[model samples]
Target: MEDLILKHVSLEHPANQQSHETEGLSSKHLVVRRGEPFRVTLFFQGRLFNPDRDSLVFRAQLGGLLVKFPATFSKPQSYSQWNAEIEPGKSVRSQSVTVTILAPAFSPIGLYELCLHILTQPRQYSYRIGEFVLLYNPWCPADSVYLQTEDLREEYVKSDVGFLYMGTSKNVIPRPWEFGQYEEGILEICLDLLKISPQHRRNWQKDYLCRSDPVYLSRVVCAMINCEDDRGILKGNWSGVFKNGVSPSEWSGSADILKLWAESKFSPVHYGQCWVFAAVMCTVMRVLGIPCRVVTNFNSAHDTNANLVIEEYYDGMGKKLHMSKDSIWNFHVWVECWMARRDLGSGFDGWQVLDPTPQERSGGIFCCGPSPVKGIRDRHLNLIYDVPFVYAEVNADVHTVIVQNGQVLSRSVDKERVGSVICTKSVGSALPQNVTSAYKNTKAVMPSNRSTDGSPRSRRSYANREEKHTLALSMSLDKTPIAGETISFTVTVTNKENSPKILKEHINAQAKEYNSSPLETFWEVHNLLRLAPYEVKTTVHHITHSEYDEMLLGDGLMNLAVVMQDTGSYERVLVTEEFNITNPLISISMTGNDYVVKNEKREARFLFRNPFHIPMSGVLTVMGAGLLHKKVHSNVSLQPGEIMEEKISFTPKAAGTKMLHANLVFKNRPMVIRGFTTVLVRAT
Candidate 1:
């Protein structure tokens, strides 16, 4: 391996501070802004170095000009190559060459053309070598942009996760997903419902799952097998199956048949949603005397952040979950299949969710029902604007959703600045090892119910253990609301454990003074369930927006204490959220080019001086009569006191001319200025 050794390097530019943000020319993706003066530095270092005694030159192609500079290798850190004498035992250790170019004065506002070329001698001879490189910087590239990651111990990798793991067995497991007797019965039932109320079948299926109704589950399976193949129970349309329209009853019956149909010139699985398709498979399997159930959950519910989603990969955390009460529940979904006892298979004896849902499923047993609770509120805030998550101080409300692979992964609120991230056990590393049987097959499928028999197989067991993590949670609220409105805050607690459990109450406080208020009144906390390990629980509190204002302004700044406690041990993680409500509206007046007077018969060049103290993005439009004569717009970014120019040409038809209005529109809002210009016209 060759170690990078620099012998000499230098910066050339109008200002030294400009050199700080230079992304080296060798970077593949170079970002740059037009009209920004920049500096360049040249560097070279190697064990073998030979200098041309005659001349060392530096060149660059900026726009059209070829700028050149004299280059020298006089300062040698590790070696002196001035003499032709060669070193036999030691190698020329280091060398460097650098040059800076001022961004051309007349560079256009768009992407400019430029390249760096280096001219130097070979190691042994004075033969000059030339190399080219690119340069550019994105606008407002910060010196330090943080990439977020979770806080986890290396041991988190070794920690075990508890899940129902069923052993895999060929005979007992049912070779095909479809053709199970139990599944067939369910599909038939669903088909019966479609016949009765096709319009509401899908909704009924969803609601049934929410209610965890075994009968509804069976009906779904039946519908999958019996309903017209082309009919989407969800959409209730007898649309074309694959390419040619077919009824659900005639839809492909077997999984293998469906696969073949998919490949066929017609009828395929593409015609329906995966869940619906899964239902079909489950139903068919039952008809053929196999057994199966659908299991679902959120992949990274309440566990990941924005950076992970933007980067499109898991950054040591789970999938990005939107911060919502049920965000954690939507992570997973799959099929749990059962056959016979010896067929139950060894390691795969437990109930396991095989197919994942498009979105995470709620953790509780509300499989197919109207979400009884409103659930947690997801909040979002634009970090660049430093805007509060909520629009109003007292009634700040925000809904944030985290999505991935076209699915909602999780949801949460911005109780504060969303501080540090706590890394939970890697989902991949959390697969449970110890297998426990929760249930054993007690009955066989009746001939009418062709579902695969799980009578031989036993269910898996789970241990209830508490795993604690320290999350430096940043909590914030929407903008403070007006006095009459109400303010609500929702808090979510995630259980990293495996078994079902409840989240206990701890300190949830909102006080004007940190010292005076007791750490409990902000919410009435309750545990909705023995939330399954890896489940999330969310609670919400609605207070009179006025009640919050007094507390917030009572001490000038509002301070809130948030805590998530484990009901068992009362172990809790505490965090504080602080915010101030202030509305400072400033008005300004401009001079110089603020007023424009144009002569109808003459062309005018106008210089518009920026008098505003802040940068802004706006458009300038020349309005006359009912028509828009000319329109000019600035980029989204602007700086204070930036000068710009505009030119307009016009011809007057009569002796008198009306005032021209120059309106500056920012963020869709307009500011107008009018000045009447007198025009004298002579008949030609």
Candidate 2:
């Protein structure tokens, strides 16, 4: 009998050999979907023997269990030929055998040890080839929810959502032009997700996606995006400790962030606020074949306790005090994944909330939801996965109290502010979709239980307008002012009183974050004006860049407040207005299609006309994450009324949504002209 020798081993997908090469398949481990055919080619040599005298048999085992398969003798072709050529001798006498096996549709999702055995007359030779991982196929008939054909298009497959980071300090509401584009890096994220241990993958496959229990998958994904666990990919940072000078809002897509995180070997991702976290989560879900959209809630409340009330304290001078555990963000973003909730049964299907932002902890981990939108809308606080917390975000009432030396001077209730204007990107479009009605009732339903003081129950409304008070106040800007230009606004205060009274007016303008407290006073005016009964006065305040530059916070959003006190009655009325200091505009136009494959070169042109009388000379800086290298061109000169054009070429390093920014600064003035464009990088 000839000694049995295993000469060459290879795997082949007979259907499409070239496509498998691009897929980066490995011989040690083969990935296939359930109900798919797995084929492999093996070459072996033996001494010459009569066909009838010697017989060879093959067998396979997974987890030490016998897996029956069919084998046949055939010539090596496709990928197998490449393996055969790499061997020492091309003329070696050997028999090429092909094995075809079918993974059953009901096969568990995991890595299975595949063993090939060659049986002869006296003994059997066994070779441990590799592992076979069977994954859940959403396209298969066994899947509960099937994605429609249209969903495979680039719009749904690759989408973008706007995030309004109005800043935490001021209310100057800038346009919601900042968008998080998702795509490109999805494949890498998906591959990382599949690297989970075999047992964990098997459990998720069986207990989650396979059973149509998307809530579990949603929860897992929320935890995996942030570095709260060892399994998470991106370490989140909200403190703005980025190595680059880029702000958290400069990130335009999830792909670049994930790519940077991966390139950094799983280090903390820089400057990710709430919107960044939610947008990236949307990309991961969509890439894994789960339908998802990013949702933004204006005036979103973070109720530390379960009570649906947010208590805010203010001093006698109208300065806000952080005395309560509850707080309301100017805007908070989260993702809504579309899946059938097999765990919750009927009405809970459709959109479910999944917030990846590391806010409050849930079940000892910093992840929230798969909280059903239906549960929140129906006020089912008892449901699982932080439904009550989410409900408070949209339905809670805000109580603003003015206190002095721990004494309550006055209290005001705002029922319409919290959880206003919940929106998402429309399907197949970039327009905003009003999803507020989906989270709450159309008609206001007062809570059956009232506070001990017999006040109206706290309820949320989708209306845009605020209710008017007895003392009407209005504000307007003189003109839309750009950065470095003077900003001026007029505040008109009216008193609706029957008799003449002495009024102490306090008019203050301060730089603030979009959703938080006031930072520094940009301009202030205080005076005691004696007015006739039902008198109205308008005051105009002007702020120069020299006066506000150092005090201006992120994005230069400012809050203007007018407070009037009736000295005799100690009654105070307050009104506020928010506006943004515009930045100098530089037109940025792309020369080619904004969407391109990874490593493909694209070009953009930046044009800016010199507004100054003198010749302006400075450096033009171009930057982007994963999209372009930081490039700076010095000695950029522009004459008065001359349009300076600079073209930049970039090759995207990763797939996904990306942003390109150009900043030009003049040596003469403290003026910066900036422009940016969003691009979609697809992975081929």
Candidate 3:
């Protein structure tokens, strides 16, 4: 272990200091003499195991001030590789790092500190070794580069010398990018681009072509504002865009504009991910002199369910596919661009969909065909329903045309019927591409549960969308504690509409259902019962433990937060609660003078000689307050009827009354018990 500490960190003076306003902390001072270059250095003092053999690494941060400051670390800079190494028992005296700060011509510099951090490798024994920050001052600069790129090819290779993933080979190729082509049918709700000139529109139309084309970046941008495909339909992947736009002035802002643009087109959903949209937007923005970046997610909005769609044009069964695995599926992409204002802040940031489109409707008229019509009112032929096939191919002579009501002279003519149209029409042009199912009978296969690895009994991943009966629910906590001292909640569901059947499964609801079902989808659907319109039905549920919940309580404070968001629309509702274990006030009476500590590391001892009020069982949370350790066992079933003798050890860092908060949950009632006891440690 190294005894490292921050020796010197400060913001040098005379720049410009805002007076101290808040308590204790003073106002920023020493504004970098406007336009003058300043130097900031952080000194580190520590006892390292070995200075000669051990590697020293450091990173300097200016705390997010937009300046032309060039920062250098005493230790080499390598992003994905380890930077420092110390011998097991050697020692080092001290080290220092320097950074040059150049204030922008338009910037108003003030007092600001620099933070430094030391890194350590993880090991079996939990070790929190060192954390320290060093402050430093920054002055103005004559003319400094805002962002600097380092030639780190050698460092990158040396530190990252290993067999890389196969997919990394794609980096060797430099291909001309295509932009904006995916936005053919995207629509942005908040934007009004109706008056954009036609010439600009034509330019934007060809923007998504090869970047090597001779078109100027500005011309392409003019075209981007006008390229709109009205017929394209996609899933509501870009739903969050309407609410915000991008801010280009801030470094860490969000990509709201890009989100709008991306969501406007269904391309994000059409491709099963937004990669095309994000890529095109980023490329277009870069060409337009706007800095941009791309973000990718393994599981994106397109395939929220595991039932992911991979793009592939069918070319017989056994042969290799044309598209590569990387381009097919498994990857989703989005773009972040410099904007004037982020949706949430003024930081130059925003996101938009490269391919925007309207949300596709699920339930629509899937079949439609032309109907044969005879003389008006002669005999209404039921060709639409009875002979739906006849409409697929209509005969010219069989079809009739009549004159309009206001015609001076009545006339009738025979029009040529179009060729056989074996067409299957849905309500929207942008319906989701249906994939061939691996199993024919979903009901039969659903019952034969199996894991993704083909295990005998596996949990099922549900991807249903029905479950919207009453459009309302009531929640109540069960009096009976199901597990531990926790209560269960019962939600009563009801439906209002009578025409449509209530789907038992929960479906993902669209934020807006201009074309499909109105109800939103949920991950799990339970205790569903059919009820008449305006009737009410209830469901009882117990909160199950999730890995995240366990992680929350693992810390000192147990924080619980629930976010109910409209996934289709991206609307959110949040509920939060916190439980703090501060002071356990109850008193604990021990039978013996000196208690023996056991393997459990608790100080409590229970002898089989005494018969307690009753045997209790639920959950067990063994903890040592001063020792900073806690263990929670869920759904614990304790057998107290047999003779039991146990000694628990409690080691406290400080001599005080440590509290133990105990809770018992039962079917009929739940009880909470709190107790505390003093711990004495022998003097060494």
lDDT tens string, model 2, 1-684? 576666766666434222222122223345565444456666777753222333444443433344544233343343211111112233233365555555554444445666666655676677876655444434444433334554432343334433333322122222223223323444544556544523245564344233223466567678777766645655555442445534554555566677776677666576676777777787766555456777878778888887889987656564555688787776778888866666776788767898888878888778889888998999988888889889998989977676788887666677767775677665544445678788988643221223456532222211113333335455556665556567776666666777676777776777665445565455777778666778887777777767776565544566666666777777766555545566656788888664677998888788887754457787787766667754546458878678888888888887876667666655555445667666778997
Superior candidate under lDDT, 1 versus 3 = 1
lDDT on C-alpha atoms for all candidate structures:
0.29, 0.60, 0.26
Top candidate (TM-score): 2
Instruction: Report clashes for each candidate as comma-separated counts.
Output: 125, 11, 81
C-alpha TM-score for every candidate: 0.19, 0.70, 0.19
**lDDT of prediction 3:** 0.26
Q: Give the alpha carbon lDDT tens digit for every residue of 1-684 in model 1.
A: 332334344333224333323222112222232223333343445433344332344344332334444444332222211111122222232243333233321221111233333333322222122322222112212101111121221111111111221111101101111222211123233223333433234354344222122223333333332224333222222222324432222222233333333344222333343334444444432322223443222112222232212111110112222233322211122343332112222332222222212222222211221110011011222211111211111112123333446664333333211111111112333322211112111121111111244222211111111122522222324334222246455555566666655554443434432112222244333343356667665555565644543344211233344444455754444434433232111122222333323332444343444444545565554423211133333333346566555655554332322223343434321122212222223334
Residue 370 C-alpha lDDT in model 2 = 85
What C-alpha lDDT, on a 0 to 100 scale, does residue 599 get in candidate 2? 91
- Worst lDDT 10-window in candidate 2: 79-88
Best by lDDT: 2
